[model samples]
Target: MSKITNLLAGLGGAIALNVIHESLKKKSKETPRVDLLGEEALQKTVEYFGGEIEDEKTLYKATLAGDILSNAMYYSMIGNGAPQHLWLRAISYGVAAGVGAITLPEPLGLDPEPVAKTKTSQALTVGYYVAGALVTAGILRAVARKKE
Candidate 1:
C-alpha cells in the first residue's frame, strides 16, 4: 500500500482508539486509565529534560496528542508487508501493544494501576488495541477494494 494510505489508516485507528478510551473512562471505573499513565509519563519526560508542567489540562492535552501520533506511527507498520498478511500483522501489533501497555509501566517506574489494576482493566486495554488495529486494517481493505 502507498505511504499515504497507510498513514491515513493509522491515523483513523489511533483516533478511534482515543475516542473509545476517552468516552469509556468517564463512564466506567473499570475502564483502562491509559490516559493517566500517559500523563504521568509525559510529566516525567518533561522533568527529565529539566522542564516542569504546572498545568494539569495542558499536560493532559499534550499526552493525548502524543499518544495519537505515536500510535499512528505504530499502526502504520501494518502496511509493511503483503496485503494477504494484513490481518495477522494487525493482530500481532495490537496484541503486542496491549501486553506492553499493561506490562511495561512498573518496570519503567510508572504506576501500573491505571492499566493493569484488575483483570477487567487488562482485558479492556487489550481489547482497545485490537479494535484500533482492526479499524486500521478495515480501512486499508476498503481502499484496496475500491481501487480494484
Candidate 2:
C-alpha cells in the first residue's frame, strides 16, 4: 500500500476504535466518555513527561494524540504487509490492543486491576478492540480493491 493509504487507514482505524470504545462507554456511564479516556491519557502523558492535566481540552487532545499513535502502530504493520489475511490481521491488531487494554488502564487509573475488573468490562473492551481492528482491515481491503 502507498504511504498515504497507510496513514488514512491508520486514521480510519483510530476513529473507528475511538467511536466504538466511547460509544459503549457512554451507554455505561453518566460522565463524559472523552473526559474519562482523555483524563487517563493526560495523567499518564503528563507524569511521563512531567506536567499536569491542565484542562479537559488538554486531556482530550492528549488522548487523541495517543490514539493516533496506537492506531498507526496497528495499521503500520498492515501497511508493511504484515498479513494479507483479514482475520489474521485482525487477530494481530486485537492482540496488541488487548495487551494494552489489560495492562495500561490500571496504571493510568482508568480501571481496576485485571483480576479485579468485572468480566463484562473485560469482554466489552476486548470486543471493541477486535471489532475496531476488523473494521480497519475491512475498510483497507475495500479501498485496495477499489484502487485495482
What is the TM-score of each predicted model, taking all chains together? 0.97, 0.75
Cα lDDT tens digits for candidate 2, 1-148:
7777777776777777777766666575332243355556568767788877878786777777787676766764555564457658766777667567666767756644322256666666666667767776776788878988
- Window of ten residues with lowest summed lDDT in model 1: 22-31
What ranges in model 1 sit over 4 Å off?
none
Q: TM-score winner among the candidates?
A: 1
Q: Which pairs clash inside model 1?
A: none
Identify the leading candidate in terms of lDDT.
1
Instruction: Name the lDDT value of residue 136 in candidate 1.
Output: 94
